[model samples]
Target chain A: MKKKFQNSKTETVVYFICSLVGLLIVWQLAVSFTSLQKVMPSPFVVLGFIGQSLTQKIGGKILPLHILASLKRVFVGYFLACIIGIPLGILMGCSKTGKAIVKPIFELLRPIPGLAWIPLAILWFGIGETSKYFIICVSAIVSIILNAYAGASQVDQTLVGAARMLGAKPAQIFLYITLPASVPQIFAGLQVGLSSSWMAVIAAEMIRANEGAGWIITTGMESGNTVQILAGMISIGLVGLLLASLLRLIERGLCSWNIQGR
Target chain B: MSKVEVNHLTKSFGSLKVLDDISFQVNDGDFLCIVGPTGCGKTTFLNSLVKLYDIDDGEILINGEEVDLNKHSIAYIMQEYSTMSWLTVKENIQFGMKVRKFSKEKLNRKTEEVLKMVGLEKFADYYPEQLSASMLQRVSIARAFAVEPDLLLMDEPYGQLDLELRFRLEDELIRIWQETKTTIVFITHNIEEAVYMSQRIMVLTNKPTKVKEDFVNPLPLPRNVTEEKFIEMRNKVTNLIKWW
Candidate 1:
């Protein structure tokens, strides 16, 4: 049974790789057959753009600068979200008082889309990295809050009872049972935050910033540099994919004991 | 001398009284099993003593001292399969010890002792997801034992298991009880399990429950439930809970 499960996972990884390769092949073929370069740049054109960006000197108008800029915003925004979200989520899950206190405002405000915050963020923090950081942070907080809330709320009450029975203080029970169980679900939230960071970067860069991936695309559109625009989009995809895979790898390392050689 | 005592446990849940004027004392080295119908507040009474829920009026004494609700030194092995899916079997076994802050040597000794006692030595490396339900329950039992608790409280610990595994686990429980001889208060919905396992079986009345009977199991160790007297006693207790 275990062997079959392992085989199926390997099969899944292979299937995923094959599908990605197939998409790239289709993209290359489409570009080759038609005058698609003006609208849809070829994968080779995009790769070449990436190669040029990568090999260019530091702080050039290329891939590495935008990549670094985007990374910075995502890290800051996500870090801020985690700082606020985790404690509030655990508190909400653990206490009726905390839930009652925060729930009304949370429900009322949660529906406002992260993009909608752009105007207000610009007004509050101005049209700079602050506004962008605000957008990214706003986009991330709600999902992390919701996921952490769920993870904490859904923790097995029996485990808490068992912990109490086994000489664990109330705080100890929360620390041991509530925190550990919430990690997988919290990571799920982080994954969402990661992908959404791409959108946030664009929103943040909609303001005047000469040093970002979002600015690259915005500038490309003005100059009619379709290759650069396409390259920026592709880079976002690659970076998002890379970050997601990294998160999964970290989760596996943290929870390796969970499934006995997962 | 008694290891634990429950005095006039009259507990009411707002309008309804779950445990009414109930009392019992558990001696050190005693294996006291409580059995009753589903709605007899058997669990409520147990939870009340442990202060899981507030009791309307009761005093629980342990080791001749008023049992401290805040000090969770007594180990409770729950009935349901509630092992931490994130933790491996060995980690779960080590959890209570970690909480108690035992010395490394002590933790190792206790963990080894309990895992071997429960016959879960070979599967120590397995996770809860990898183990069967019965095995998961054993890990819980192992965790409780690893703490070397002053009191072991179990609520229908083997209720989910099939007959063969239940009986085998019961044998394991008996061996551990014999070796450690700590005070125990076991709660079970099954009449036969109470008869087989307990030195004394305390039965409760319907919600607003009180002690209806506290039976002393005279049956020898390595109990034979198939025997005529065993069946007779089971039937008598079965009627006690089933009938008014």
Candidate 2:
């Protein structure tokens, strides 16, 4: 069984690499043969620019430093979202009064996109780090809260009853039963929120920032450097993939029980 | 060990009566099985006894006091495998003991005992999802028995298992009951299971469920289902529960 699982994993990685290579080849061919090259750089040019950016500075900072700056902004906003959203979601799920009081206001705000909050955030906090954080928080928080609420509310009542019968206090039930049971769902929320925060950081940086992946793109566009823009996009893609994989690894460690064929 | 007395038990769901004017008593160290037809409020009745469902009009007393979980040592095995999916078998078994703040020594001792008894000692580190259906049920059983509660409530715990697995589990339960001497109030729709396990069988009628019959089982322990007396007893309870 273990051998079968290992073989399956190896096959998946092989397929993934093949698909990526296939896409790059298709992109290279299109740029070489079609009028699409008029607007965009060839895949080779973009890839070379990305490799060069590793050693050479893109703006005042290296590519990694720009990514790090965006990461810092995303981290602050995403962290704030989690601490606030998880508890609030649990409150909404666990208490009728809490839900009744908060849900209407939440519902009213939920439909508004995080990008839409930019103007208001700028007005409220100015076009500074605070504004960027606010925008990213707003973007990421909705999914976090929604997923956490779903996790908390969906806890099996039968388990609660069983806990109570086993001499669990109300607080103990919440801690031991409600909290652990909701973890997988909370992780799901975190996954989505991280992506949202990453997207928001780029958008925020695009509007006003000296250093970031978004800044790299905006600067590249100003100079008509299509290769540089593609390089920035590729970096974003790689970083996004890395962040998602990192989160999945953490989730695997924490929620080993929820995984099948473990 | 605990004696349970339920009196004037009544429950309704938005004017639809489920259990009506029910009353019964379970003596200390007795294995009492309550059998009824499907949807006859057997679960509701058990839930109400455990105070999982609020009684419209009733009183449930454990050892002469109202059934308060905090004050009473009680364990309930739900129809669904209520094993904490996030926890391993050992952790699940220790959950109740941990909640009740059992001594480290007692906790370890009891956990080991129940794990061995349920034949889940090998799977102690395994999570609920990793286990088979019967193994999951055993985890639930081990978890319940680890607490060594004064009263144990089981709601059709083996209802989902195949007959062979069910029989094996039944024998394990009997052994556990004999060794522990805990007062058990088991609820099931299977009359033969009730006859096979219980020292006393209480038959409940259809909706607006009342106690149709409550009788002692004269059949000795390590009962033979193929025997005439066992068949006679199983048939008697089956006839009472037959709706069609």
Candidate 3:
């Protein structure tokens, strides 16, 4: 059993490496064999650009600094969404009046994507940090609210009844039963919300930013530097993977009892 | 005394009356099992006692006062396992005591005691999903017992368990009752189980439900299901509400 487990772990790393090597091989072959090489850089060129960007400036800052700048916007906006959306969603879910008052307004805004709000966000907040933050918040808050509302509203009635029978008061029931029961779902919301925040940051940065991965891509386009754009894309993908893994680790710690967490 | 009194209890869902003026009383520490035909509103009767449903006419009193869930210390085990899925076996057992604001020392003691009683000490950290059906039912029972309730209501708590596990849990339940002397009102469709577990058996008729028989169980403790006297009592109760 131990051997089998160890084998699967090693197999996962091996498979990941094989897929990346396969993709690189195909890219290199395409560059060598096709005229499309004029439009796109070879795999080696992009890799070299990424390595160079680690130490040298791309637009005005190094690649890591650019990635950090984008991450900061996501943190601020996503944190705001969590604080505001979670409580609002729970209130809407738990109270009939709250649902009636807030649900219609939320539904109206929900269908409009966060990227779609870029123009209005710029108009409202004047292309500043506030507008960018607003876009990320708008993108992320919907999923947060939806998941929190689902978690709170769909709590098992039997558990509530059991709590009441055990002499829990209204407030005690909410705190001990309702809140804990809703946690796994709240984490689910946060996961989606985090990804949304990340995406919104990229879109926001693309429009107007002096230092961010998105700025690297847009400026690369202006200067016709495919290597810079590919490097920026690669960094975004890596950072997104890291952020998601971190959230999953936090979820496992918070909701260890949850089946999904395990 | 932890007596439960139901007087003139009547409940209706729209036009269909499920329970009609049903009334009974259970004395302190009495193990009274309520048996009825399938779909004869047995669960609705239990729900009425818990005030989960509003009865059109009746009063359910615990020790001479109207049933106030918050004030009264009562533990109920429903047909479903009702073990909180998010909680471990230990936490599920402690759930009631924690809700009642038992002191930390008391909570720890009660949780340990009940976990041992249910034979789930080793599985204390195991989630409900990891447990078997019988184990889940045991967890529910342990949770109810941990509360040290004045009144315990169970609605076919072992309904999903197989016959052997059901018999085992029934015996375990009797042992707990004998030790604690907590007033228990158990509801079941199994006449044999009712005969095996109760000091008295109350039979209900088809809906609108009413008491068909309320009499003492003549069988002795540590009841042998195959014993002639036990079979006789079980058959008598079976005949009382046999829909088939």
Candidate 4:
């Protein structure tokens, strides 16, 4: 059974690589052989530009530096979201009063996209890194809080009862049972929140920034440089994929028991 | 080990009463199985004993005073395998002891002993999800036994397992009980299991549950189910619980 599982996993990775290569081939062929090149750059051109931009400057900064700036923004916003949202979510799920107090306002704000806060963020914090961080934080905090609440609320009451009967005090029960039980859900929230943070940072940077991936795209658009635009977009896609994979690796470490056949 | 005295315990949800003025006593280190018809509030009775549910009337005393979990060592195994899914088998076994602040030396010793008792020492590093249903149940059993509680309340902990596995686990439970001599109040709908495992049997009536009878089992240890007296006692308890 273990061998079969490992074989399937290897097969899946191979298939994934094949599919991505096939998509790139199709994209490259469509641009080279058709009128599509009039509007879109070939995948090869975009790929070459991305490789060159790693060392060469795109907008006074190398691609790596621009990507690094965006990453730093995402890190700050995501960290703040986790520290605030996790505890708030657990409080809402664990305490009726906490839920009653925080849930309505959270629900009201939940549907408003993080980009929607860009204007207000600029107005409040003045078109600076702080405002960008605020927008990203807003974008990420919703999913973080929601998932945390779900995780905490959905904790198996039986386990809590078992813990209580085993001489776990209320605090101990919350620490050992509630917190651990909510980990997978919290991680799920973190994943979504992270994606949202990336999206928010790009948008925030697009509105007004000299450095970052979003600025690369906006600058490309202004100069009508389709290759640069495509390169920036691909860079964002690759970085987002890398970040998500990193998150999953961390989750696998913390929540190995949740994964089957491990 | 601890003595349990439940006096005139009554509980209700809205207007429907579940446990109605039920009373019972369990001596220290005694194995008592509570058997009743479905929906007869057997679980509610167990919950009340552990103060998981507030009794609308009457009291439960451990030794002499009110049952306080802080003062008394207790462990409960529910019908569901309440193994912590995040912990390995060994860690799950250590959970109760860690919560109760058992010394590290004692916790390590008890964990190893209970893991071996349940024959799960091999799967000590395995998570609950990787184990089969019976193995998961054994993890729960090991966790409960690791505490070496003054009282162990089990509500049909083996209800989900197949008969063969259930019989095997039942024998394991009996061996552990005999070795540790922990006071146990086990609730099960299985008459044969109750008769086989308990030194005394308490049969309860259907809803608005009252104790129909509480009597000692005269059967010897390492009993054979096919034995004449064993079947007689099993049938006797079955007859008492038969609502139909």
Candidate 5:
């Protein structure tokens, strides 16, 4: 089993490299040999644009600073969602009255996408960072709350009974058994919430932001520079990948006893 | 004073009556096994004793007073593996002691004692998912014993194990019971296991469960299953349990 795991790790790296190379080769060939190059620049041109944007200003701020601005909005909104949503979810899951009071409203609003909330967010908080944060928070909180509720509600009753037999009070059972049991599921919610947060940030920034990744892309489209547009998109993709990987690392660290962690 | 007495216990689930006027007593340090037919509400009876389910009538007294879980030290091992998955084997064993608020020194001592008793000292750091079925059962048993519970209730804890593993665990249970001298009320559908493990066997009727008979075991400890006396006693209990 250990050897199989090690082999799979090596295989993943090999496969990832091969697929990336395959994509770049196909892209380069399409640009060199086909009329597709009329609208789409070569991979080298886009790569050079990204390289230059690292130091040069896209909208009065360098690429890293633009990325940072968008990230700050995501972090604020995502953290707020986590703080409020997780507790509210757990409360709803563990108590009948809590579920009754909160569930209907949550379900009604659940289907509304983060981007759909943009107009309302702007109407309520205007085009400032607060509106951007509101959009991200609304988008991210849904999954965070849902996952936490599922985790808390799905706790095995048998363990709860065993804890009771071992002389645990209700509070002790919740603290020792219910809380630990719900952690893996809460992490699952966090992963989904993070992706939604990233998605919402781009849409939020696109509304009126002057110096963010979303603004860079919107401005690039206006200026008719496909290379800059592709560069901004590429940065979003890279940063999203890094955020997911970082969240996974934290999950594994906290849930080392879980099979996924192992 | 550790004696448990149940008087005319009756419990019903809405329209269905599961337990009907059951009555029994378990003396201190006595290993009492209750054998009943399948779906005879053996688990319901155990749950009622632990106050997991409220009874419709009668009373359960641990000594001279009513059974209060908070006042009495009790432990239970369910049919399913109840080891906390997020905790390592050592931590799982310590959980009950921690809940009971044992001193740090006594907690460490009891943990060491139970782990060694169950032969799980080396695998102390392994999680429940990493351990095999037999090892998980051992962890549950160790966790139950770490608190030095006054009354230990086991509801067919070995029901999931294979025959060979079941016998090994049964012996391990006997060793622990003899050492701790704790009052035990074990429920099982397996008549042979009831006869093999218990000092006294209480047989219950099929639905609306009632005690059919309670017989003291005449066979000696270190019982051999193939022995004529053991087989006779096993067959006697098996016949008493005939419902289907």
Candidate 6:
């Protein structure tokens, strides 16, 4: 089993490198054969643009503006979701009344894409950062609530019975047995929610924004700069990848003793 | 004083009656084993005493007081592996003591004492999954003892072990019983084990189960299982349990 795991790790690393090389080859071919380079630009062209920008300052600003803007949007929306979703998920999982009340509302609203919420969000929170924040918040909250609920409810009933028989009270049982048991599941939900919100609501930002990576793309496209557009796209993908990796690390850290190996 | 008394006890599941008018007594410091065939309500009776299941009829008393079944402190070690999976052997053992609001110094001392008693002092850091089935059983036994419980209820505690490990655990149990002198009401399907462990054996009939036979074990302590008297007593109880 240990050898299998090591071999798989090596395979994945090699696969990632091969895929990057493959994409570069395709981009080079596209630049030579088609109009895609005129629109999307070649990978080398975009890398050259970013390299030039590394030394030259643009309007007394550097790369951090776009990076910081995107980071702030993610943190604000994600933090709000965490504060509201976790406890609510636990309650809904444990109580019939809570599930009965919350399930209907979630089902009705959950299917609507985050981008679709832009019109109402603009109306409600105005054409500001709040609208983008609302989009990400909506995108993440349902998964957190659902996963947390499932985790808390899925606790071993026998353990609850055993604890109660051992003289633990209702509150004590929840604190000692149920809550601790549900943690692995809760982490799973948070990972899913975090990654989804990171990737999904960035599209909402593209619809209308003065800042953010999504806005960076729109600005480059309007200015007819393919290299800048490609850089913006790459920025989005890189940030999403970094955030996803961070979440995976957190999941492993928090759920080290979880029953499932993953 | 009789630490436990079951009076005219009756319990049924739906239309099927599991126990019928069962009664027994265990004196303080006595090791009483209740043995019968499979599905003779041995577990149901034990569960009823702990009030894990609501009784259909009758009452159980602990030392002349009607056991406020909800309020009494009883340690129950089930046959199946149900120890908290995340907790280490030491933490599992200390659970009851923590629940009972024992002081940290007292909890530490009792944990150390019980870990030594189960010969699991070295395995205290192991999780339930890391330990063997017999070792897990020992942790369960240790948890039950850590509480310094007045009434200890065990349901086939050694039923999951290999023959050699089973005998070793039986001897371990006897050692703990002697040291703590806690009143134990053990339920098992093994008649030989019943004879080997108890001062009194209650043989239960098929459900709606009732006490079919009761025998006092007159054999001496540290009794040899290979002795002629031990074999004769085991055969007698085994015959009493046999049915078509």
Question: Distance (Å) between predicted and true CA of B52, model 2?
Answer: 1.5
Candidate 1, lDDT over the whole model: 0.81
Model 6 chain B worst lDDT run, 10 consecutive residues: B64-73
Q: Please give the range of 10 consecutive residues that has the lowest summed lDDT in model 6 chain A.
A: A55-64
Tens-digit per-residue lDDT, B1-244, candidate 6: 2388888999999999999988877888888999888988999898888777889998888887876534677788887776887788998888878877899999999999989977899999877877898888888888887887777889998888778868877887777788878788889988778888898888899989999987788888887889999999988998999976
Q: Report, for candidate 4, the interface RMSD.
A: 1.0
**Candidate 6 falls in which docking quality class?**
acceptable
Q: Candidate 5 lDDT, tens digit per residue, B1-244?
A: 2789999999999989999998888999999999988888999999998888889999999986787878898999988889999999999999989988999999999999988877789999988989998789888888998888889999988877678768877897788788878898999988888888899999999889999999898788989889999989988888888877
Candidate 5 B-chain TM-score: 0.93
Predictions' DockQ, in order: 0.58, 0.88, 0.76, 0.78, 0.85, 0.39
| lDDT for each residue of candidate 6 in A207-230, tens digit (9 for 90 to 100) | 576667766667777888777777
**Reference-based lDDT, residue A7, model 6:** 95
Clashing pairs counted in every model? 3, 0, 0, 0, 0, 0
Could you tell me every candidate's TM-score relative to the true structure?
0.88, 0.95, 0.94, 0.94, 0.95, 0.86
DockQ of 3: 0.76
Residue A240 of model 3 has an lDDT of 89
Using DockQ as the measure, the top candidate is 2
Tens digit of lDDT per residue, candidate 3, span B88-207? 999888888877789999999988888887678999999998899989988988888888888999998888877776776788889888988989999988787888899999989999
The CA lDDT at B126 in model 6 is 76
lDDT by residue for model 2 over B25-135, one digit each (tens)? Answer: 999999999999899999998899888899999898999999889999998888887889998999999999998999999999999998887788899998888899888
Give the poorly placed runs of model 5, Cα more than 4 Å off: A1-4, B162-165
True contacts kept of each: 0.69, 0.94, 0.75, 0.87, 0.85, 0.31
Candidate with better DockQ, 3 vs 6: 3
For all candidates listed, what's the TM-score of chain B alone? 0.89, 0.95, 0.94, 0.94, 0.93, 0.93
Candidate 1 lDDT tens digits, A1-262? 8799899999999999999899989999888887864478777877887788887732355577778888898888878888888788777877889999987888988999889998888789987678888888888888888888888999987888777777788788888899988888887887887777777888788777887778778888888888888777788888888888898889788777555325
